[model samples]
Target: MAHKKSFEALDRTQQDLRGNSELMGGALVILFGDFRQTLPVIPKSTPADEINGFLKQSFLE
Candidate 1:
């Protein structure tokens, strides 16, 4: 699982995401999912808590 801190690091730096340079150093990252379709299983947590874990706050999103 990806964390917010890691994405912050990438966002802080300048990256060239063109041609082979895209994946030359770091892996090309992508996120695909619909919050309306599914939600993560946070056992014993309320819906609000689960929603709080949303990745939208991360730069990777």
Candidate 2:
């Protein structure tokens, strides 16, 4: 799983590139993963920070 910011950045980039304000610029996005398997790793970060960095904890979720 990736960090929320990573997904957000992708969304922003897609929006900018496609000139669409919608999520992922209304592109066809296919994601395959086991979200429960692992969380995003934040180097030198606290447990709380790591948890909060999860994609599930983001607006995209």
Candidate 3:
């Protein structure tokens, strides 16, 4: 039997993903937030301009 520390490894992986995703916004921008809750510490961008591009070439008809 092997003792694998999964949770500790996951924290580092999640941190890296968050850092990398900060710069990407060209694709489908899905922002999951609650208006009743406080705002985020990091800045966020809405892909309103990219919406037209995505909709024009989306999978849905």
| Residue-level error in angstroms, candidate 2, position 33 | 1.0
Best model number under TM-score: 2
Mind giving the per-residue lDDT tens digits that candidate 2 earns over 1-59? 67899999999999999999999999988987888778888889998998999888888
lDDT of 1 by residue, 1-61 (tens): 3334545555444254432333223555665667455655567988786665545654455
Deviation of model 3 at 59, angstroms: 44
Q: What ranking emerges by TM-score with the best candidate at the front?
A: 2, 1, 3
Per-prediction TM-score to the true structure, in the order listed: 0.42, 0.89, 0.25
lDDT value for model 3: 0.33
Q: Cα lDDT of all candidates, in order?
A: 0.52, 0.89, 0.33
lDDT of 1 at 60: 51
What shift in Å separates residue 12 of candidate 2 from its native position after superposition? 0.6
Name the 10 consecutive residues with the lowest summed lDDT in model 1: 16-25
- Choose the strongest candidate by lDDT: 2
- Runs in model 3 deviating more than 4 A are 1-4, 20-61
